[model samples]
Target: MGSSNTSFRQGFILVGFSDFPHWSSFFSVLISVFYSLTLFGNSAIIILSQLDARLQTPMYFFLCYLSFLDLCYTTNIVPQLLINLQGHDRTISYGGCVAQLFLFLALGSTESVLLVVMAFDRYVAVCRPLHYTTIMHPLLCLSLAIASWVGGFNNPLFQTSLMMVMPLCGYQLNHFFCEMPILLKFTCEDTGGTEAKMFVARVVILVFPVTLILGSYTNVAQAMLKTKSMAGCKKALGTCGSHFVVVSNFYGAAIYTYLQPQGSYSESKGKFVSLFYTIITPMLNPLIYTLRNKDVKRAVWKVLGRGTDSG
Candidate 1:
């Protein structure tokens, strides 16, 4: 929410707390534990990728970026939430609210863009194996990462700035953290244009990435069919399956949350989908990636052995 009224002393302040479920204690504990696990899991991914030279490859490079993004994205909301669940008011100052909105958008958008880049990396490695190294050269990878960050930075500027122009008065957000939709709902003004801009942002961040991932997998499938070898098919299928799983978990919940029509907003339903994307997906990424990937498994063992000997 934004304040257009220059004279208004204070902007939107959250007036009421959410009505927790009867089983809120159980759910709160679960949420707090999941939040801790997400931080630990993603932190390990970042650390392991950076520490182990053997894990330093184009794939794991992108993964480390993803893990870092997830960590930042999850941190934006979850820590505040734990504070709220402990019966604290969890009031964010106006400046702090804007910062939260920007960081959340930047990291979330970066992650979406990075996933597309990752798909292209996989496509090159599989479909055009001869050129994989040259195509995804270190410089190219660096440039792509920079572009993702730049795009992420710019995309949210429009949305957040627009909100800043509007005057936030008595409207309080319904959701735990500040999301674009929830913030817009609390603006207490007509959001006709804001809604459109947000929809466009969602398409830019999400739809294009999904298209790229799907296209990459389609090409991989075609290449595998041409190979006519069981081993070749298996390898191709394995790569595709891993990518699909990650993409589905990340994108599915995100699209459901963002792409809904403006007035059709269901607060409870929105909360559930937001939980899936914000909480569930980060927890799943490293577990799914490492458990299914042999190279990462070996690296994990190597690290464990070193730790054991050191201890």
Candidate 2:
């Protein structure tokens, strides 16, 4: 145990793309560009959702929270990643790794639940338009948002606590960040029971939310089919389609990463998949919403027009 403590205190080397040292510079630049876009895009969504009166509905309210989550999510991972990619010093302190793991899991789990919540909002809007306002009152929205966040952070507390006590065999983390499955690879003892428990937790966080999102979308699709007017059908599809795309991208990569058996986990493939969720997805979210969403586009032009006139 003392040796384990000393090993942790000494910190672990992040073997991030070291095998492809020549490509590190390229990835560094690409990630930097994506990080900047993620910051700009998600920030714009949050600001527009607040500043535009048209966007003050339940959908945008949830969008604002989603943007905030994406911002924190990318910020937690991208900077450390860029640093590791840019320099030869590929080490992270023990505390930093723990913080990364905790935040990563919490933000991810929260987003999973939040996506389901957004789907529920869409279902209410599409299926029960008459009672949408009554059903999705501001208080209810707030309560759901708060619950998502609280549940997200709570998930990591137990998982991280379990990982911290396990005796590790080495100091080389084979990936870019401190992920649970990758971290498990270093455990020296029999981790079957622990892995099973963590697997159940992952399923709760990943699978359950996906199942809920799918159910909500199924209802939403039925409602869309019943709408006789072409315009109404188009609008409903546009709204739900954007969300479905986001959900597909996020949950697809996350499920692939988390659901696999530990023995079959491919470190090389995992790195790229991690890149997609952590960096690419956040950048794409605002684009997906804005391009497909007329209200958000109008809000953007309104804000820009005001800026132009003031200038």
Candidate 3:
């Protein structure tokens, strides 16, 4: 009888596999190259920021922290994705899957929190220019940074703990990674109450940070408008542009995934957008900030000792 039960559990449906994106060889190469570039570019930014004493301002400090987050954020998903693409059908063990869910949740949440903190940094820098240093001093920045990580960790810990307690019997996960919503869809047990509980968790973990970001940006716009000089306003707008672009992409994708009704989970389209946040955004972040800002360029060159004219 025990053997029969074991065999039945073993025969459970495996809805997921290690096989990666279904693409031609050419497309595979293109994706591989893109992932490599993302890793290299983000690492360089972190290194450059750390070595350059000139980049010790609040802005660059947050940027360095962001680079670190991007590195972690992409690392959570991309490497596994690449392995799967190589025809490995990467079968993450049950424990491994749980760990991935935990880390991914933590890092992703932390990043959202960090983005809000950055918005606050910009608000202080622009709206309270006279007291910017006082408001965004080093100690305060460190504290905020630490708080984001703690908040990130606590969110996943609570959610995952709740999930683990519920019995998972026959269902297999469908997506490449262990996204909370996708995982929730597969449980054979009653998940209605679990789903509601998770929804409340989402509201607390995600909605509050989003509200903070919106409030900060609102203040920033008001501050920018009140500036006496047109040049000052223009410069402030330019400085905020990259942050705005990143904020839009990150929050837009996240809102669709987490904030939507349960029935709205479109497997195909949602997976594609999830890729944007999990893979593409991290790569584009450094590029967006560096290309648009002259200060970062000067600092990068100073640290690396390279120039446009010559090697």
Candidate 4:
């Protein structure tokens, strides 16, 4: 908030994918479809988790957390992207850009943490079923969720402040969105030290959660293979498969984008990678969960069928 307003007051033009002028219409249409689907899918999950008592368990609780985070995550970026893609006005005010950057990082960082939490939830359900109730109490779940939010909100604070204070040559962003890495490109100083700091932050916010998720899932896998019931083994494999798919979908794009030093960042690569995690992932998540899980499908039916039955 304390950053200088001199360069920002004029606002920055988000160049987006303007390089491909011919594809604007196609991009617009594709993005609109994804945006619409992301909103509807995540919203349905959140509502269904609350409406169906069967979903009152810890898994659904964390599913709702993921749904909510993806909702906020895409809502913060996709609308702006759609507008920039479809309309001539690609300019976001300095304040708007900063806010977008901040919110996106917060939601994204929290979602990364939440994924680990969800993995832990699965581990408990599968590996420690006996004490799952006592371990994942409502209060503890609430605490974990809050900690995720807090960690996310704080991750970008110091770095953003530092980035803001650094001098930038121009207000034109080569990409469609405002992101820390891209913004770092414009800063006037030699970004060697800054890039180091960013890499460290990325490790903390992104890598740490990913490691946790992997560890939790590994435990789940080990425990799952020992189960003698064929039916139970099949079910466990399905659940773990779905979770791994989601995990790979998210972490793959994010790690590729962030883990590298800023010096190695490719504008085109960053643009497409950003497109994946921000637009594509949210749209795909609900489909993955619902198609893969019988429980989610039943919850959807129960929630949507109520009004129809009454009518």
Please count the clashing residue pairs in each candidate, in the order shown. Answer: 6, 0, 3, 0
TM-score of each: 0.90, 0.95, 0.89, 0.93
The model with the greater lDDT, 2 or 4, is 2
Instruction: Report every candidate's CA lDDT.
Output: 0.77, 0.89, 0.76, 0.84
Error of 2 at 8 (Å): 1.8
lDDT string, candidate 4, 164-224, tens digits: 7777767788899989889888777677887788778889988888888888888887887
- Residue 289 shift from truth in candidate 2, angstroms: 0.7
Candidate 1 regions exceeding 4 Å error are: 1-17, 306-311
What lDDT score goes with residue 167 in model 1?
55
**Model 3 alpha-carbon miss at residue 146, Å:** 0.6
- Position 150, candidate 2: lDDT: 91
For candidate 4, the lDDT comes to: 0.84
Candidate 1 lDDT by residue in tens digits, 168-270: 5453556767777776665557778777877888898889889888988889878887997898778877766776788899888888877888678877678
What's the ranking of the predictions by TM-score, best on top? 2, 4, 1, 3
Candidate number that wins on TM-score, 2 or 4: 2
Residue lDDT tens for model 3, 90-172 = 46666666788899888888888888888888888788889988888899999999998998889889888887766554444
lDDT of 1 at 99: 84
Q: What TM-score quantifies how close candidate 3 is to the native fold?
A: 0.89
